[model samples]
Target: MAVRGFLRGIGGKNAMPQGASADGSERPLKPIAMGDGATRLQLLDEFEAGGIGWFWATDDQNRLIYLSPAAAANFQVSHEELIGRPLTSLFTLENGEDEEAAERPLPFLISARTKFANMTVKVDAGGDPRWWTISGKPYQDANGVFLGYRGGAKDITADFERQRDNTRAAHFDSLTGLANRNRMTRRLTAILTAYKAAKRSCALLMLDLDRFKAVNDTLGHPAGDELLKQVAQRLERIVGPKGEIGRLGGDEFQVILPDIDDRGDLGELAHRIIQMISQPYSLDGSRAIIGTSVGIAVAPYDGIEPSDLVKSADLALYAAKGGGRGQYRFYSNDLKDSAQQRREIEEDLRDALSRGELRMYYQPVVCSQTHKVKGFEALMRWEHPERGPISPAVFIPIAEDSNLIIALGEWAMRQACEDAAKWPADMTVSVNVSAQQFSTDSLPALVTNALASSGLKPRRLELEITESVFMGDAATTDAMFAKLKKIGVRLALDDFGTGYSSLGYLRKAPFDKIKIDQSFVRGSTEDDNSNSAIIAAIVSLADALDMETTAEGVEAMDELALVKKRGATLIQGFIFSRAVPQEEVLEKLADGNFVYEPNGPEKQRSQRRTLFRRIGVIHEDHRYEAVLRNLSRTGAMIEGLLEVPVGTDLVLDLGEGQLAICRVRRSQDATQGVEFETPLISDGADGLCTRHRISPYALAAAGMPLAALPPGHYAMPDRRGARPTDNRRFMQVDVGMGASRAA
Candidate 1:
């Protein structure tokens, strides 16, 4: 009989008795009596035993009632061993065709006692790693009871592995071995959805490599690719296990930090990323220096959604690049406005020289031992018609990025030379040089023209350059230096120890002076900082080379003392005097005396700037208005609390997102000196600010999910709906308005 004939014969009418049996009941199919039919049945059994398709059955208890002999042989087990075992125990289900399917296939169907078809499963116990595809149907008798399951299976190990490999390829980046954008975006969405319910915080850092294009342009794309690999490795070291890092393609990357919201820690991590990534990289013996700029945004504060948060971080990255690359910034609402303002400023800077809106201010660099002015460093002051006196920190970078730096540099040099020529012949005038200006071929001629036009000797003019000038072609830098040396002007290396300090450049470059960067002096008064020792080492090295050392940004008396004690030849900072107008320099010289008095604070304390702004004085539940006469890092001098005894605790609502818990350390008349419970930290520049403010996260529970603190007086939101109580201790008085009667 044919194969189809054999399959139909088992259920044929002739194969079983169609009439009633001896008990007058319907009879089921029995064995066929034909010899060829038995032969066909034997052939089918032989096919199953010859390692072809297999069959299985289970009882109502899900115990395997039967197992194919060939299938058991392939499992390297005997038929008796698998016959009575549970089906799930023989193989683990692989969640069906959907690689990312959520529901567990086999167990779910088994628990429901439902029928399933073509479920792929991995063999639990294996020799060469076996996988099997299984199908089953729940069989029931006339009583409607689930008697058992009859199933069929076939090996599918090869096909399943091929699909697995294809899935991995789609989810990962080939270059960095990080999650590709597709997978990361999905992961972020899932995580944020889950985290939103839990009310947890997450942080996102967006990064773009600075000067990466320069590397790719100089070297080929292959080198750029190699550099990216190194960058990913360094990032892994810094962010190990803290979060997931994904390369969003090219030089841009994103980091997902779960449960981290502290800006201070984020800022530090961002700083480390910039610093470490900016370090020199050696690719096939060709040295390259590239930096990174990072922008950070925290969840629920920056954005509740991924796109919004990513945009916030991207805007911050734009701001960081605009502010000067190689730094990091936290997301702020003002960045958008600032970006536009910067663009306008960049445009205005183009004609600033011709319009004469820029002027030079002279900061006296004093001789440490004599406390007399040895030189004046020419600093640019942009007296913008609208913005008024833009900081060099802000405008200089913009000018450099634009085409204005070369012209600005020329003007500064000529003006400084002319001014120094009019000053006492013994004093020198130093001028800063941008990397772009120094790299230009016209710099040599600019220096020569300035000296000749001003009728000043070259010895009286000094040129200050940072280490960044050495980043370009060494031959060009060498030639530029030789030309300046030929002009016989004194050279100073400024902002030393802030970059990859290659001593080889120090050895070759003809620098007459070494200017220690302000970073080393920032916390040198502390016993723990290695900055003091580093400063000492720099001074010693400079002295060994017969180069004068000037410690820049010595803002405190203690810093001044420390630098001078460490053998610094000159000090330039606020402790001595701030940048003054040229007329003041003339006045000091007119007296024929170079002695300049250090008119700063008497003691080496945290520097305080005097202010006359009003602040809220909170006592218990009542808030009083008081004048903030002066503010420091650790304390403030407030005037208004009349006769407030020393040691009285108060909270100062320093408007615009600051609340300080202070204790009155001194009380005289209406003036009180209050010390902060926590000292303030730097705002990445000369400004001081609080480290952590009252979070908007805590405010949302009170019915306001504030994105940021508003600029106005804010009372602490009362969480409980209880009776109000106001305990007024001190009488509210305003001396400016003539002290009123006590409340």
Candidate 2:
């Protein structure tokens, strides 16, 4: 409608309002025939004054021409003050305030000279937000000359706010107010997509709470929820603005760290997370204790896609759990194999309890001054049907994950106590307690059962628990200690200052002994290590607390001397004795003497182990059979080589592709000691091997394209046959069974 059709003129004659009529003229204000035009205008004006809807108009320039009295009052401005103001000054399209309406519609529609209807935009009053759904139509005269725009607006502030809240609820976890899994998934996908193009790095940390189910089962669901909220708060504090943390349902969480890939930094972060989460939580005044395992994966390195990255991180997490809870692991390509092996081990461990395959070996812990054994620490050993001896390192964590640790713990306790009953009355048996087993409520009952069944006094049984045991409910831990102490068993803190190290635990927990971990003992005798100082401090601390200190993993005489000088009250290491079977222990004790002679190298050095395996020694043309009596990083002693002169070069075929090129340094009748050309390196376990193997590329040139050398003796084709001339350097001789060597 033209502006003239809507507004009456000021003169008695009906004149066109500004920019209204087609011609600059007015119609005579003749007396109404049927309907009264003036009266109708009055009624429309009254309706516009009502507050139901607001009427507004703007000129071609978008400046306000007129606003209904009601609309003016709502903006707290009079009509005269609002009239010449720009329309855009009153309203703007929401800047992402609504998912549907992203930008202002008025300018675009007006610029196109088109009509618009029910376009919602944000209107401002003071500083509060007000929403309005405005409908407008552009006006033109009969000549098609543009006039202005007229519109009516309805407030939609309530509806708009409600929708925003609903969207928020949908994207966030209700209990924790952290991003839910759905939001996390989208966020990760988006970040990975963008980061890949930019070649930037991101790290994702996957974390799962350890022993959370026990807390839920013990404290009920409400308490569990409260604990989760507390955990979210802690994560937020740790992560802060550096990353985004999301609760991935239940006890799992995901943290997205941008622009970080250094493993050392990630490791430190993982450690802090482990420590922070392991701290006790107060749930409704009843303490809840739990730990978390972290697995970290980085972008463009571990994965370029979100799903793959998550899977990689998950594998690392599984590895962390398999390595025992409360630790972190970075994703490695080998983790897939490890995870599969862990599954298989878990399955095998279930049947192990019934298969009679589990056994215990005891390592003597001796008094340093007297060299008399005070007690034995029981170490669990498992032998698979086909795998032969499976390391405790590989199987114990599998048992823990399979929820079989409690059973294993109970059985070990019973067996150790039973075995100790047959030992000398002065000897004690100390058994290790897993974190899962230590947190069990039935632990004291199991101990009582073991003691009663074996008819052994409680004092003869020692319980070794690690620092992880203190990670649970404080009251529960304290009570368990009280109960065990009341039963007359001694409590020892194992591997102190190596894992979860905190002097505070020593002050509160009633421990009778502190076992210095091997990590501190391994290099303590060297000048470049702090292990010696650490040992001294630990010994001093233990003495001040009226606790005994035991130095573990002393491998050399110098280590022994260092530990002794540091005031270790007791020592448990290979220097004293490797863990021995109970029968052998009985045999040694039958002599009525408990003293052990420390028979080792006069001068301390790296590990030199005694062995008695026959190997082939090749010299020039012939291979001689000899026994490797002792092996070390630098040299070895071989027996059964007759009259070999010093400075002779020989190659000893150590099985499994290892060929030691050595020069005879010392010679004697049927015994010659040889030093290796290149020192051996650790094979990542409790073993050593050649650092550089024969290259497969070289072997390929030799017409053997396999990955490694075959297990037997080999030599290059030569003119000399098996029986060489007397001038030839060597000859082959077989050392038959029972290590009887012939050279």
Candidate 3:
């Protein structure tokens, strides 16, 4: 069997030729008897055809054989010369006893063959190291024959290099050639787990670029992308060997510093990051500048788990952003509260309109000269069921920023129009329009729909637009105003003196009214030179344009007087009245005797007289029986048991079928104020009074006393005519005496 194996090696092929026998017979080995031998022969032929050389040899005992082209090439010998050489002599062993370390010898045992047993051996050709695979088998005869060793070698250097490149790409950032998020996450997870086990501290710092979008928008995306790459490089330099830096995403990065020395290290890192990122970056021959805000979460203190640490870091990032950019913040509990509050407010604002918690209140705008109600300006108010009343000063800016003002404005228009429908025909209602609301093309449609639904006359509805409304494109403003005017809705320029371009707005827009801002009103009352001049100029401009002027925030009587003197047609302020409920407005309207007195000593006296007269008349009527009282010009007081609510208008019947209309000025217990709506006496009744022999006393007592009495007859003085005590002086003296007695 050994001799046959040696002969097979010398044959230089895996199979015997046809018509030959395996027993050294002249007949060749049959194809059916060749068990893998044919495939091996084909593999060898293909290798040789491809310019690969081969040789075969037997081990020292001549029991096994090895075949391979690589062996001849390594020995720097031709395949024919190496054919029958001893397999052990084909290679040299550095150490005889170090069998495991020795190069895999040829003619190795077949039973020991492994799928991929890699080995390196030095060949005689320049003594170069050659890699190989050695498959070994035990020698046998006939069907059980096994070769000593058989293997094939292929160059794997290029393949190994390609794999190395792929591994690098998978772990590194392509742009900056630094570690990427995946690699960073893996490393960070391992570090965090190890640190937690050992109870050590570490810090995770998150850095985000501020105003980076602005750079991208203004400088183009290429410049922006370049800037990010430069930022990553800077971060890598700053962190150096102390920590690992990674590009988490665009304009965002993360740094992990494991085994921190002290808390100061975190602060130092934060400062370094800020300093490095804040520096200007040059891109495409142009300089670009941006800032970075960093958030740091420390292990064992901020969080124990990786997810918790990341969350805390994110919270800190939010805090850094909140405190303005270009700064760093550490994780803290306060940030959690702030985040929660912001979320809640944002959520509530989104649902505010749907919740139906918003309302509009109308405050009367009175004519400065006539002291008559001219119009009402609708103001929005928000009453949150949970948060109570939120000030307009607080929520208005928020709404504007969030683009919620558009919906709020629409709601206000609809509500104001509905409320205006309930007012007198002549009274107009004005609604404030925000710049955002006016910018919408749907504004006019919204207004038109509101008017149609509320049955409010278009001419009686006014829109108060701020100066900012006209600050945009002139053509747009002109078109908008034209559309609004075409709808027959009056326009008023509100806060006329408060804005920078008020005069410009006024000149461009044809407003029916110009409202002097409250700041001007407040300042004008104090005789502020600039504010007063502004007001005067506005008033003059209004007069020139045939436009009415309204003064807002007229808190003092002097302000009202000044506005009236300045020819302001309307006045709205706390002095006249604060905004009240609809019922209160109706009550004020019914109280025809109600008069506004300016602030002063004499004004107080007159107000007291008015108050006492109203109270006395109503109270006397409630106390005395069969005594009808009418507010006459004289002092006579009549009493009857009746309840007249304050501000109630009623008709009083005097003797001889005379009647007079009066409104309740003051309540009698639960009674209302009264005012004279009509008088019983007419010019034609003079002769009738004289023919009836009725005296002027009854007519005078019924609130119809004339300074120059018309020609009339006399009536019974004691019953029908007013008694002689019905004198103005007597009422004044009685009121004075009653005041003194009460005191």
Candidate 4:
């Protein structure tokens, strides 16, 4: 309507009269009553000069023939300089802020000579970003020959930028500056859908901060927020462009790693994340240390859908935390069962101490030079009435979570002190103190009571504390150390190199010894590893501080020899002795045999996971049931295939879509050892799994509905339409028929 009203002055039918209409009296002229071409041109020039809107025209070649002086000034150039410049060159289609609006490219619209209205575009003025809404129509001569376009445009930069800010705030975490929960979910869903078509893979990682609640409770929520910000920054540095990380609120974070399915690489990255996050954080003049447990799942292998994948990763994360707070686990089908069993374990553990299911075992920490027992580290073990032995690794974290560790730890400490008083006077006992137990004020009083009740000298009761104890409140930690030192009980730093190692704290904390973690000891003998150097540095640091060093988990003579050579003052592992029961400790003390000889394997060998589970053995078209007795990265042992040739190739159907191609390296009667064609990778736990699995999409293409891999064997359907009648060459023996044969 406004344009029509303005156009009336240019000789349109609605033009008003300017003067008297053939009468004596004069008539009032309309505001824009232009009776000549010069007046109409003057009005148009004034409109352009007012910067209300600007006109532009292009020749048939889409080159700018004329632009209003005001609009030309917006580009910071003279109108003459912009003349003959390609109109499309001066303005480009806006980045697709709105998908529908950018569907038609600017060049395509101009070349097609179509009428376009209110198209959002960016003006290529060499300054801050400028956005405009342009409306244009194709013009032509009376003969219908096209003469390009005439358009008017107005700047919308401010409005467009404001809208973009709103979009960003909606999709991103305002505090961490990372994508928020909504954005991460949408991104994961989109990537999985796209990757499903391409048959590619994406790995999802779910991590929950360990002991984060303690930080909040101790230092307040503001400090917790600061700690979270620091954690986000660390994650960004580590993940960078490899993946997208998002905080799912509170202490939970998720990472989406595209094109990454290999568990080995994922495990490495997860370990790095755990290590980096476990380091102490300085927050508002207070120190807070925290750890993370990560769980990983890969697309099509773990699950085909977003929810399933997330659930799988979450299950893995639960397992990691349950195993121990500072670790990572990859998804497996058994985790669901484990998750259920964990809840039961937690319930059972609440009453374990009263039921007498918990007992203390002592592993000897020997003198490296004399091979004599110097002291013993008291370890806790659980023996469920029906389930028998339960690993501390499986139950300790549960106790910590359930707040049973304080009571349980007190019980173990008292028992250790009582038992140590009866042992040879020269020998000492070391009991582990958990971070949860140390955080309470009752620890020092409990230690004092344990010593007084057992009549054991305070020096004989060594309390081993991990690096996590230094998490928050440095002054409090120092006070605790002072109190313990005043009580005359020795303090040994346990798991020294397992992340959170800081020389700054070591300078003041009164520690009597440093226990090198098993992780460093396991690979110290390898020529390619730097574990040896790390061990040397730690031992030297301990020696300089007038402290002793104990190399933990030395199960091989070579590892023991390496640690001893590197000047470790003590050794504690299977190389000397496993943690013995109280009865055995008493029996050994009566015999007066304080010396322990190195009794492990002469050299380190590849660690193989020992288990007895049934799996399928496939030969040609026949699949026979067999027992998988044990498995390693490179090979496995099986039974029930009688007289199979040693060199014959076979496929081992380890269920859940995992198939291992192997050749029988050794065969004898019903027993055979096979070597894998491709060595399996770690399953992020204490097991091996194939790096690649039969995808669920492929299963769907084979007439099965798409879903997460089920617990049964996945075999190719028989396309021959009939079963082959070939007789079996090898007998399927019942290896478990030992009772009948003996009868």
Candidate 5:
């Protein structure tokens, strides 16, 4: 059958069905079939209208029997020009590889009769290689001669180029043109894994610029940006190919070295980085220099995980910066321990403040001349349930470094003020102020607030500060001190002699009192001319300034006497008492003996004694019948077996209470010490009285009778086994009317 019309050989008109069915209805109509040539023409028209590129070739040859206009357009040629041309002719040999000839056959292409095959073919265009995808299928007439294949070709050069660009952008840093963090992380992971497997080591260095903020603030951001770029470039040069450098952001950078022979190599690199960055950099015609502090965490030495290693490096970096800038530090176990401890302490401090675990103790500072309590120094005391008492020496510095000192100082001030409100109206309370506390602008406000809240008079509160507090900017210190002083709060230069005591500052700044350093007090009476001179000078300076001086750590009578002679008006030390707790302070107050008593005969005697003569009393008192409680040349404390009347004149009885004469020093309780009217008889002859009128004969008579006296009447021999005995049996004595006896 043949169909020639557009309607496929349809009838010229609506023709009646050839077969008729029942009820006058047409049963069906048979359509005519088209020829193979007609079918082929229809497919070609569809392909051409759809803009699809097509090619048909036989396995026997690479030549194309049919080619669509779209396919020819891909080759920049007309359909007629490519219709009989071989497919290989469209693509030039890339890389000079040989191409199949048009007459040759491809076995793989010949076997594919129904299925389509796809392949990439390289095409040359203007000396540049372009890629294309070629899809084709073998075709043949049914039970007849073999026909060529037919498929499509699409250009993929742009897709390939886009892919290549994406890869490059993913792995590199665009700014410094070095590997980005992502690439460095991946490389580090692989390197670490390899190192672990091989049992090797490596190091990671983290560095941050020191005082970079100051530079950035003084200069412009643009200068800072340029400096960073230059730093990155310098780092790259230093690291070269041996290691990888990466900027973690801002002024922080990191370096990773694999298979490091020694950790020192990293240290050397760090030192170099510090030195190089520390060199002056010109920014906007002005030279700026900045240092770098580096931290190094070595693999297998610091940690196994990348994050852990980085954390250690960061901790070490902080340590370097904290230990003063321009240094490098290695990660150590102790550093981790200290870090952990600090974190714990910070947490504990917060909890402690909330839990009200902190308290203050008061030590009374008294007036030496008036013997009246004038003030109390507030000392911080921590009583932990498990740790017992923790010293401020251990935690105060820590608090300052962690910035907890501000809060702690505020708390302490409030507490001291509250306690001061409870103290005697005339007694002031002084609290030590830390240097860090002074740094804050709110310190004066804090003091004012504390006073207002506690309802305590500002005049009743004193602030104790060390010399170091004023060692900073002169103007700043002066301003701060002036403001504080204007508030009616007394200021005392604490530990005055220990620090840079520039008396000029003392003169300029208005201080109400100077507390002599304990160090000077501890050694002032050692008979050292230098110490004595220092004490004298301090006292003189205080006098010249019309400032009250309080001598601290006066542990002995000589120290007290020396400070007194130097005209120190106030004294604090173990000689009187230690810094007792609040409860104990009242008890010490009740016991009032610590108050200096100038009129007291015992005290007067103690002050007049020389150190050498004080020791002599213990040697000579074998059975002089006295227990030397406290001794001095001019006066001594003797607790005797016999009670001496308070106003009695008595002989000191240096030799068996017979030769030496002394008036009965005012007796307190049962203790008595007499001042010798004359030097004791030291003559080797049997009981010769050198000064006192008692003769050797009288000593012999008294010794014999005292031997029979009751134990209560005489003092027992001391541990040295010396008993009161009359060696005067060999001599005679002369009694005089001026001589008086104590026993």
Candidate 6:
């Protein structure tokens, strides 16, 4: 019954109402008339005692004047202790999405002397997690003097937590706990917009697993889900607080790195990501191996908008995968064309062999001590009718992706054996066995047939294989190895010391030689890196295993000397000779010339790339078009500026937001050699670029509307009949001819 009805009945001389006490015993309510002071106080006492709500009052100073005794007990504090405490000491308003609401501090509300209702706040009750919905009203005294708040509060912890959990579920991925696609998209858009205004740089990385589908197909979807979780954890560990990582559906992921544009640092991070992700994984007592390819794009330089930047990165990723798995590539403007070209090559490659456009060339591998030819490695060449010669590095990965490598490998093995049969009796021929070819049960039979058809001795044929062939079932891999060994042919580990090298496999596999990768051989003598030590260790290990070691890519005499001194048994590189046509090799051997003397640069020096492309050269406020003749990490050579003086300062606009400050060190007629003020860093490829660039947003702030970086220098005037304000300092020269001449 309502309190008013109960009170009215009590004073009507009817009957006292029955009520249940705290101990569940029946009790009679004391008779009291409606509007009586005792009745109102008893009503409030019952409300507080029932744990539905609590009353509090504060003085004009906002300090507590009174609080319900039961509320004080809940706080684990005595009523007297809380009597003089500040009202804000017990509760604080939580910040909410709407800033203009009761999210304001409790102190502000009391100070404003305004009524506030149902403001959710955090309850400071002895460190226990609790929330309360509090309502309060400010009052005035009889003399019109201001008074503090009279408030009531009720617990709302459960309700508040449920809302928070729902919000989190909306933004996070339930499987991996990373940000979902929607949240990632929103976050990237917001960040790009804010950073554009701030003129800051951001990098976006797109990653796709190389063989993720294989895992899902073989191990089951549950294991694939588990693998994705592990991948997220590993990425989190590597990225830390540097950026945000998100799973962009399927086996693809993205990362947003703000305020970072240095390609050097980005390349290193990408490399680490590939290496860490490529490591072996264990799932449900089964072992799996997979790799990743990364494509990176920086903001403002690559694109001013989010969609454009994402497209640029995706193209770069496509290029990286096209180059090979387990690699990273930085986005460049030309990648669009490169992507189109890659598709054309893939389409054309399907019928290149049938058209008889493929041929095998051999590069000699010679003894380090005697410099005499011991063997030759078979390399494939594709002479495209319309596109000219194509490098194997470009087409091999394409062939592998299309499942055409098996046919290509079989033909190469047969042709190489046929060619080797005409060579010297003691000379051997090495044919590469791709991972796809080695995985099949027909490889040994294929090898046996090639040897039989060519009438070549079994001992004269060597199958060069990479470490990737080991990424199969251990028993199956061992059986393949045993069959190949039983075929009476030799085996050599190609590109050893690269890619998931393990001594455990080396101990059991029967191999005749180990060919050190070129990456370790280059610059071993030029820098103070540990590459030299690594080379020595590989040779020593090969010697201990009674296997010959060949150092590859030895182009300079200093590198040759170092590798030889390190006890390498053989050498294979440009220092001897690049791969030549099979006919040329046969002709040379027919003349009984089995020795190729070492011929290369006496010393290894910094690599400089030769090119002839138009670039902008700026002096003062004038920009002139020039042809860049060559480029290096430290400097460049340019033509089209006649009689330029030495020590002249100029800026070379290398396009795509790269403005390189440089000084002319050598000037002779139309040729000028310049030294960069700061050394250029790698462009995550075989090129150099400035570490930082001007953002398009900054240009927009300077009167140009925001857009992607346009072609040509920023200060280049319109070439359609634009006049120069001052006389040109240097004369223009025509370098298009074989030589530079006056224009």
Off by over 4 Å in 2: 1-155, 368-372, 439-442, 453-455, 467-479, 495-510, 516-544, 551-568, 574-578, 583-743
Task: Residues 711-738, candidate 4: write the lDDT tens digits.
Answer: 8886644422346656766778677763
Model 6 lDDT on a 0 to 1 scale: 0.86
* Tens-digit lDDT track of model 5 for 1-743: 23333333365444334575534487777554566678777777787667554544534365766665554555555667666666666664222111212422233444544444455566633356676666776556787656666677666668656764575467666666666677767777877777665666668888887656645765677778877888888888888898888877778888998866343456567777776776556666654556678887777546666777788788887666655456677765556665666566556766677777788887667677665678788888776656677666546655655678788889999988987786667778989998768757899999999999999999999999876565344566788998998888999989876534667657788899999987686656554447777878988998889898988766666776778888887877655555566677556555644453332111212233221111112223333334445433344455543455655444343322223335557666455666655543311111122222222122234443211111122221232235555432111111123232443
Could you tell me the C-alpha RMSD of candidate 6 in Å?
5.9
The worst-scoring run of ten residues by lDDT in candidate 1 lies at 682-691
Error of 2 at 697 (Å): 28
Question: In terms of TM-score, which candidate is strongest?
Answer: 4
Clashing pairs in 4: none
Give me candidate 3's TM-score against the actual structure. 0.38
Q: Mind sharing the TM-score for model 6?
A: 0.87
Model 5 clashes, total count: 11
Per-candidate clash tally: 0, 0, 44, 0, 11, 0
Poorest stretch of ten by lDDT in candidate 6? 95-104
TM-score for each model: 0.79, 0.65, 0.38, 0.91, 0.38, 0.87
lDDT of each candidate versus the true structure: 0.81, 0.79, 0.62, 0.87, 0.63, 0.86
Candidate 3 RMSD to the real structure: 31.8
Residue lDDT tens for model 6, 442-497? 99999999999999999999999987776566677889999999989999999887
lDDT string for model 1 (1-743, tens) is: 46545644676643434565645589776765677787787876887777668889999989998887778777767778888888888887676333446765687788689989878788876677788888999988999999989999888878888886677678777888877787778777777777777877788999988767766765678889999999999999999999989888999988999988767788788888888887778887666777788887777666778887888888888777776777777766666787889899998898888899989999999999998999999999999988888888788878766768888988889888988899987899999998778878889899999999999999988999987776565666788999999999999999888866768768999999999999898888887889999999999999899999999988777788889889999999998788987998898889878876666554456778889988888877677888999888899999887789898989898764567889999999789999999886544334455655555566666667645554565556553243556566776677788856665
The candidate scoring highest on lDDT is 4
Error of 2 at 611 (Å): 20
RMSD, one per candidate, in order: 8.4, 13.0, 31.8, 5.9, 29.7, 5.9
Ranking of all candidate structures by their lDDT, best first: 4, 6, 1, 2, 5, 3
